[model samples]
Target: MAIAELGPVVLDCPDPRALAGFYAEVLGATAEGDDEWTDLKVPGGRDLAFQAAPGFVPPKWPSAEHSQQFHLDLLVKDLDAAEEAVLALGAKVLDADDRSRSFRVYADPAGHPFCLCAC
Candidate 1:
C-alpha cells in the first residue's frame, strides 16, 4: 500500500494571507484560513497553503548562492493574456525573453518563483 496521501503544498511567506491571496487569484481558487496560515482551495487538484514566516527573506531567482527551493507551474492556453493578468495581480517577470519557449517565469508578490506554461 502507499505510505501516505499528499497534502497541500505549503509555502513560507512574510504574510500568509497576502501570499495565499496571490496564489488564489493565480489558480482561480479561494483563500481560506486565519492570519498565521492560509489555504487556497484549487479545484480538481491539491490545495496550496501559506504559512507566516517571521523575517522571511524571499529566495533569489537563478542564483546559485540562494536557489529557489521550489516553484509552481501553471498551464495556460494563452500565455500573453495570462502574463498580463499575473502582472496586474502583482507578479514580477523573472524571465520571459524567449518568445518561442513554452513557459515563462514570474515571481509572486511574496517573491516565490512560478511559471506560466503553455498548455
Candidate 2:
C-alpha cells in the first residue's frame, strides 16, 4: 500500500512537558495522555506530537551553519498580539523584518523557527 497522507509531526525535545505546553498554549489545545509523549491536536485534522528525548539538541536558526529541518506557519489576526501571546508562552522573538508586513519569525523553546503571519 502506498502512503496516504502525512501523519502527526513528532518533535524531539529535552522535556516533553515544556515543549507540549508551548504548543498547547500557542495552538489553544491541551496535552493529552502521558508526559513522555504528549499529543496536541490542531485544527483541520492536523496534530503535533512532542516526545521526551534525553539528548535533544535545539536548532540554531538564522545562521546557515545548521539548516532548519522544518518550520510551521501560523496565520493570526494581529501580529503584535500574536507575538505577545507566543512570547508569553515561551516563544522567543528571533527577528521582525519591517519590510514584510504579513509575517514575522519566532522560535520555540527548542529554537525551532516558525512564522506568525497576519492574514
Candidate 3:
C-alpha cells in the first residue's frame, strides 16, 4: 500500500493570513482562517495552507548559504501578464535576465521564491 496521500502544501510565514491572502489573490482562491492559520482552497489544483511562524526567515534563492527550501511553479498562459500582475501584488523579481526561458523567478512578500512558468 502507499505510505500516505498528498495533502495541502503548508508554508511557514510570519503572518499566515497575509500570506494566504496574497496567494488567494494570485490563484483566484479564497483565504479561510485566522491569523494563526490560513487555508487557500485552490480550484482544480492542490490546496495550500499557511501557518504562523514567529521569526520566520525566508530562504534565499540561488544562494549557497541560505538555499531555497522550496518553491511553487504556477503555470500561466502569458508570462508577461502574469509577471505584471504578480509584480503589482508585491512580488519582487529575483531573476528575469533570460527572455527566452519559460519561467521567471520572484519573491513573495515574505521573501519565498516562486516561479511563473509558461510551460
Q: What TM-score, computed on C-alpha atoms, does each candidate reach?
A: 0.97, 0.88, 0.96
User: Best candidate, lDDT-wise?
Assistant: 3
> Residue-pair clashes per candidate, as listed?
0, 0, 0
Query: Model 1: runs farther than 4 Å from truth?
Result: none
Estimate the lDDT of model 1: 0.93
lDDT of 3 by residue, 2-119 (tens): 9999999999999998889889989999889998999899999999999999989899989989888789999999999999999998899999889899999999999999999996
In model 2, the number of clashes is 0
lDDT of each: 0.93, 0.83, 0.93
Lowest-lDDT window of 10 residues in candidate 3?
61-70
For model 1, state the Cα shift of residue 82 in Å: 0.2
lDDT of 1 by residue, 1-119 (tens): 99999999999999999888887887889998888999899998789999999988898899988789899999999999999999999999999999899999999998999999999
lDDT value, residue 56 of candidate 1: 89
